[model samples]
Target: MMNYERLQSNINAYKKTGEILEAARFLIHQFNLDDENFAGFGFREELEKESILLTANGEIGEMQHVMIPKNIFDFDLTLVLNMLAHEMLHVRQKSPRMMILDKNEREWQAYYEMLFHTNFPQIPELSDYYKNFFGEKALIYYSRMGEGSELQLKYLEQKLEVEKFLQDIKNKTI
Candidate 1:
């Protein structure tokens, strides 16, 4: 197992300049997440051509590189925390096949968790999007541990189909 003390020390060094990294550690502990293969947390000034606001790569249960685009720091703390929570949810999704769910399903689950459960202030647009898609009661029903999970998966599939249709139309219009 990795030495958490050393990790905390490293994260402490960033407290002065890298609030995001410190927040990452805080979220990890808050969520009681497993980050055994989590390699390191930092920011990149220059990102790849197709990079996301936050990015990670590498095999499951092995060293994984997780980073944030430096520009993301310019955004609101809630947005930053939301983004970090979304990515950390991915860390919890490890399975024998690397990921138990498809991309869209994983994203849906992550968004639902971040928006409804993380206790972080949500971006209104995102919360509205979820509400529009799943409605408030349905979101609450699906957010629970063992309740409505199967139905949530069913709803997720239908939501993905609708999203794909919308995306296709947008592409056509463009």
Candidate 2:
């Protein structure tokens, strides 16, 4: 299905740059993604939406392409890894009949998954970096879902669950 050689080659090409290779490797291992379904990934200056920081494309729940902002390399490695992790979560959601998750629901899941590793007690430095930096971003992003009625309530529930999970990590209960 997947051409491991080509994927490894492509990932290796980013070794001289920031931690892009490491970030990709971490997600690949974390998700246990198939080689073929992975489609492929790249950094490009040309993206369909100028406002889009990154993009992930897939068909029937399998990731086909991931186009990242070339300038993302200029940021902190943790942020870059976090962004990649978020997009990959979207790619992961596509298959198995494309479960109909709402936009905020999907965003909550992606942000939660992206920040899940921050709970690891073994990697305190990484945990701290993510908690200090990206953790607030997650809160801010999900906060937008707290607006109006029934649908918003469901979104808020998801946001609260993620908040509690992060809090548990902060308290070292997890």
Candidate 3:
């Protein structure tokens, strides 16, 4: 179960920073990500464009590093959560050690998982954007991952269970 008290504490801690942190926390729990394995260090504001990158050098999915500009923090909390979840999915795939796969492939997998798993209803909008830019083939690939295979269904069912649990907690709070 997710530690709601701890999540609430973290939310309070990042109150001055903005709601992005809280959204990230919700995603962390929703995905069952281990905070110990993933690190959110070096969140200092940058003047340049806001971006999040996954570094596979030292910790091969053991640590998550995020960089966000101060200006864009409040503009889009969902975008920030999506970026954080995207990187965390890379961490889940253990992509850092796999040298044969290119960054694009890794990103595709992360994006696919995020779109399929997250409860956030804005996924269609995000998927449309990706399909527009990266071509419909990628989106088609993601949607087709379950045509004849039971594995994708099982995975999605588990994701739905977790998401439902998180939603239950959110509802109780309300």
Candidate 4:
């Protein structure tokens, strides 16, 4: 298991001046989420403690999400990008009255979007998009822990996806 201290250290050590910008570029080029400023991607110490389930709250970029930490505790650029992509999906999925009624479909689509960049072509106002669905107060919650969990498969899928996506991003950056 990866310790939090070591993982956090890894992120700090692999630091860059334009992590935010790079992330934005990544979303734009790879995910086709052409936003000039990735204002939605926020980071904090507390965030590392929350998974995507606890991170989302019917708010668009309002949630301070850990973004990339999985069970591995590694903080490489890939992990950071992976985390950002993961949270971006949540941000993309934000609806005011979001519900668990379609968790599987949402997650399935989210996973696919993260991997293949087949997401919404443009960024929309999260609040407005979900104002009627989940509202500002009604947060939809789901985890890979219940009867719906294909945890291992999802993990593998994300791992492969991140790896490939990161490589593609690397090719562009290089």
Identify the candidate with maximal lDDT: 2
Clashes found in each candidate (C-alpha, N, C closer than 3 A): 0, 5, 0, 10
TM-score of each: 0.49, 0.54, 0.44, 0.34
Say which prediction, candidate 3 or candidate 4, comes out ahead on TM-score: 3
Q: What is the per-residue lDDT of model 4 for residues 4-109, given as tens digits with 9 covering 90 to 100?
A: 4564454454344335433334443553543322344333333444332213333343332323223222333343344345455655555334432355445545
- The candidate 1 region of ten consecutive residues with least summed lDDT is 119-128
Q: For each candidate, C-alpha RMSD in Å?
A: 10.8, 7.5, 10.0, 14.3
List candidate 2 stretches off by more than 4 Å: 1-14, 17-37, 46-52, 58-63, 70-79, 117-129, 146-148, 155-158, 161-174
Cα lDDT, model 1, residue 116: 53
- lDDT (0 to 1) per candidate: 0.53, 0.56, 0.47, 0.40
Give the TM-score comparing model 3 with the true structure, all chains together: 0.44
Candidate 3, residue 13: lDDT: 55
> Which lDDT tens digits does candidate 2 get at residues 74-170?
4554455566666666665654555535555566666666656432222113355465445566666566666675655756765676677667667
List the pairs of residues colliding in candidate 4: 67-83, 68-83, 95-130, 96-130, 96-134, 96-135, 97-133, 97-134, 97-135, 98-134
Question: Which pairs clash inside model 3?
Answer: none
What stretches of model 3 exceed 4 Å from their correct place?
A: 1-27, 44-62, 95-101, 118-174
